[model samples]
Target: MKFFSRLSIQSKLMLMLLAVSIASILVISYVGYTSGKEAILENIYYQITELRNSRARQVQSYFNYVQNHAITLAEDPTVIEATVSFTDSFNQLENEEVSSNMISELWRFYEKEFIPRLQMNVDGNPTVLSYFPKENIARYLQYHYLVKNPYDVDNKSRLDMAQDGSKYSEIHQNFHKFFRSITTRFDYRNLFLVDSETGNIVYSVHKDTGFATSFKDGPYAYSGAANLFETLQNNRERGAFEVIDFTSFRPSYGQPVAFIGSPIFQQSNLVGILLLQLPVNEINRIMTGNFQWKKDGLGKTGETILVGSDYLMRSQSRFLVENPDTYFKELKKQNISDRIIQRIKENNSPILLQEVKTNSIEKALKGEEGLGILDDYRGVSSLVAYAPLKLSDNLDWVILSKIYVSEAFEPIQIFGKRVLVTSAILVPIVTILSLFLSRRLVMPIYRLISGTKKITSGQSNVVVTVPSDDEFCQLAGAFNKMARTIDEEKEALEEQIRKNDALLLKTLPAPIVKRLKQGEEKIADKFPHVTVLSANIVGFDEQCDLMSAEEAVGLLNDIISAFDDAAQRHDVEKISTVGTSYLAASGLFVPRLDRDKAVIELGLEMLRIVRAFSQEKHLKFEIRIGIYSGEVIGGLLGKQKFIYNLIGNTAKVARFLMIVNSVEGKPNSILISQNLYEPLQEFYQFFKMGEIDIPSQGKMAVWLLSDGSHKK
Candidate 1:
């Protein structure tokens, strides 16, 4: 205290202010830098995540849309009708003296109308029709509609006009042309169809969308058939998209694109695949478009970036785009930073991100998904986000985003500098004013603190008071009001929970009901006990021709209602029904080990009612049933419809049993799966039938019930 008396008052004060100001500036700058960096990085991360998810979804949607369209066309009633009509024609061919003259004229018309449209030589000799004879000739000409004239020169000579005994072989050729026109009008770029029975490429789009040569070029078109067959075979088992090389049979457009193939079914029989190719450019755009990179404060020093899980660049430096060709060369030289170089080597998985370079940006490119960093690659630091392009396991190929760390931190460095400068000047003035106000402010603050302490000790109705003219006085009054409001909110919240619990109980089981109350996503695998029952309408095909479409559907609905009522009566959960089939399950709400008995009892009751109704209405119909008891997966399906669904392999087997053992040529009846059979064999009247083959699954021994009743 005595040493301070030697200095002047103003001098001491100014020095004290300066010292405090500098210290404050340093602390403020660091805190601001940290906070700003975190905020900016968080935002960038969010953007990358959104971008990746959006791109993956778009690609999946596009491929799925294309795949579905091809499937629909393959199963089109028109196509089926055409094939059936053609088959009938084949039957007629065996009888009539084939019209050589008129059919020849029609073939000539097909050659003019359809053959020339393919823009390819039939077999390197455009004029040679002799090269095509049996199956190929028939399919290639399926789509033509032409006016016939016996006098036409091309027709006269081409039809073996000299041999008055020549038969007009035009049905095969004319049909081919009609199919081509139908496919063209559909606007499917590269539609290819193979005969499931013959293993032949029956329909191959040969214009710009197909092979450059016609089907008559045996090796050219035949070469693609094997590839298409393999794709279909593989996908049928995986039940999803599978990528294959396209260089052997290239597309007419740019670099060969990816293709998806699906089996076309005639009723339940696999006919062939309907295939389409997706453009490579669309996938490229999504993978590369959303990357972000910005320059640092000093242009000389920039932050490089690498994409993170969110597919946003995570970098401490700016991104500078480089020629991709040169970029590869630089990576080869190992001139890039360790972090970036390492990423390029360890590219694996669908999507991954890693810091491979210390300074230069680099990212791994493994399939379509894997982590890669673009922050710093090859000596130059740039905001780099690397994501892999991945085709979906189920649908389309996907593009994942990976961001560089440098770009993620770009704004942090910029804001940090500004905060440092601002605090340097502001701290001095604030220090001086704070010293003068400290004592004066303390008295009012003390009163506010005491009042706040009382309220915090659960005194909800407590009131606070402080100096009238000070900010502390206003704060104390606001605190008292807030406490009262909290008390009211607590009461309202308790009442809301009571209502929510009741609603939740009605929709889900006890455990799930609790989870719902806690606001959790409904899980699909958590059900402890469940029962499943499957019912299919009898003789569904006969109705298609016997009754009008509306009447057929109405009857189907009526049939489903009887089963639905039985499910309700027996307290079973109705899961879903497909076409004329009805699916239901039980035990998700309450566990009953005797679920098999419940399902069997329900089936018997439903059968009795259906039989009585059929007799009363003089309707000829029967319901086939399959029952199984097992744990089931349960969940909500969609946001809008929100179906509470059950799924499991047990459910699948039950459905299969219904199809396999449904007394195919007799009146419909219930059949139990082998799993269900084991438990209730002694209780039911079932007769062993040999074995039957099912699609995908080879064969299984099945039994028929003499009567629906079964006791446990």
Candidate 2:
């Protein structure tokens, strides 16, 4: 204490200020680092969770599409007639006899062609007679479609006529093209017509050994086809569809296969079953995102998988497909069955073969949707997002979007390193700032107070001076005048600044305005993660034609004001309004984890606003809103009359969607692209509206917002 007293005033002040500034900076940096860590974790959780929800929606949407189409085909008039005619003809051939030469050729075909392909896929030997169609009618039909057909096994569906001079041939010829088209167009493995009465598969589009076999008493009676037939018999509800989980379908050479079956009803009477062989390729494509995992924002070591309630994988793992050595090494550590692991290796896939047992999988299997840092199936610590697919109770498929914990938190680790380096660099800088501020700021106030004391004692020509350039210098310059009217003048200046700020804010975002005031000429910023919403008001011009100019302007003002309020409420920044179009964006001034969600909410609210305005004010106007998310450049355009504007393909796509939806969609349509839907499916209800091809942006899938609910 005595040594400090010996120092000069500026040195004493510097020491004290340096100590205070150091302590404050240390405390603030610690708090900021801890809070920033948590904030980053939350963002990572949200990112993976959004990906998981997107994959779940994709799976559910695809199944729903196939289900609706299956039911439609079942109810088609042509299909109904084909079922009646084919069953009658199939039954009539129960006593039909085949010559000895034809029987020999059938056996030869199965032994030489079928079994070779079959054994190439399956481990054990499967007998031909076990899968052979039973009864004379089945044998006769198989001989024509399978053995005697001119096309190979894959191309057998091309044979429309057997040329055996039978009614079955004529029936097959009439309807074979239509059924074959379904398989080709939709990428189905096969299509089957099963007689509802006898449980016999009377016809098949791609005739395999299972063709013309009876689901009731055939050798392969316990197959997915039989399971589907029994399910339809148990449930007679309209539009009921029975889906069989993936199994080793022997008819397809023990390859994994799933089934989708709907009952064919001819005027309220069950005639036949319409069965579609759900191609695993299509399901895999949806689950794996066509093997473009990185494009979906899943970083290195990140993958999305589907697991059934049985704890077996329903989709292939990214590591297994891309890096088999590491995948198998991890599996070995878990003590999994060698045979099962070997089988997966032989098949080069994990679907229905590899077991995925973990806490995340268990939670998802229980129909829970959430995210956490947990050990995954491979026993690696992972950041995971889990959810149950809402396709059906029977499927009970769970989806997981995950990345290795090390990779997910890699950014945080980098931030921590940067903090350490920054702390080291900031100590010296803080010392300088503290010493400069103490000398420049403190002595001026002290001298000013001392001079005021002299003035109070009736002294004349006493001036307290500060040489530094700042607000304090202005105070020193007008010291005499400031003492009398400081409060009034300060208030007046603040009011003027407030008016200017409001005018600037009305035209530009707060962040942009701040940059302009800070001497940043040609103000510009690149926002990589923002969502843009473009909305168009329809019938407004026609309504304005009937009204006077003042009334039309007033109506537009009311709508724009309401929109501005909605944008504020939803945390969206209004960019511009041109004629009947209003444009907005999110994650510009302030970053948000829910940028897509906020913009979607704003778009929906704007639609509601327009609807209410039309009804409340008796106007016949309509609104269509569209949203797209991507990178954007925001900057001033014009020299004098410029406002902060967003320019990018994102805005272009949004405008196109708005215009397209206005023409073809409902009066108030809110359409979001696949990019936006992927992140918000868990929170919003969306209806897939097919694809729209833009001029420069190619084809994009669009979903219509349903029920105006975009929040959980």
Reference-based lDDT, each prediction:
0.51, 0.83
Tens digit per residue, CA lDDT, model 1, 1-712: 6676775444456556666767667776777777777676566555655655665566556556766665666577665544444444433433334345655654564466434532231123333253223332342232121233233422221221112221223333444455556545644335555554444444444422232123333333443434655657555642333433232242231223345566666576665555555443444333444222222121223222223333323222122233344544655576544444343333211122222433211223333433334333345433333344344442212233444455456567667656766766677666666555554456555555676686567555656666575666677777768867866775676678777665554444455556655777655665655667777767665646877888777866776777777877887766776787777777766777777777877877767866776786567767788765565677767764444556666676677777754656235567665566777778887766656664444675666663544544
lDDT of 2 by residue, 419-458 (tens): 7788678878877887787777677767777877866674
Evaluate residue 679 in candidate 2 and report its C-alpha lDDT on the 0 to 100 scale. Answer: 77
Task: Give lDDT: candidate 2, residue 428.
Answer: 84
In model 1, how large is the Cα lDDT of residue 201?
42
lDDT of 2 at 287: 73
Q: How do all models score by TM-score? A: 0.35, 0.55
Worst 10 residues of 1 by lDDT: 157-166
Provide C-alpha RMSD values for all models, in order.
Answer: 59.6, 53.6
Candidate 1: segments with Cα more than 4 A from true spot: 1-15, 79-188, 196-202, 206-226, 233-254, 265-271, 281-398, 403-407, 420-712
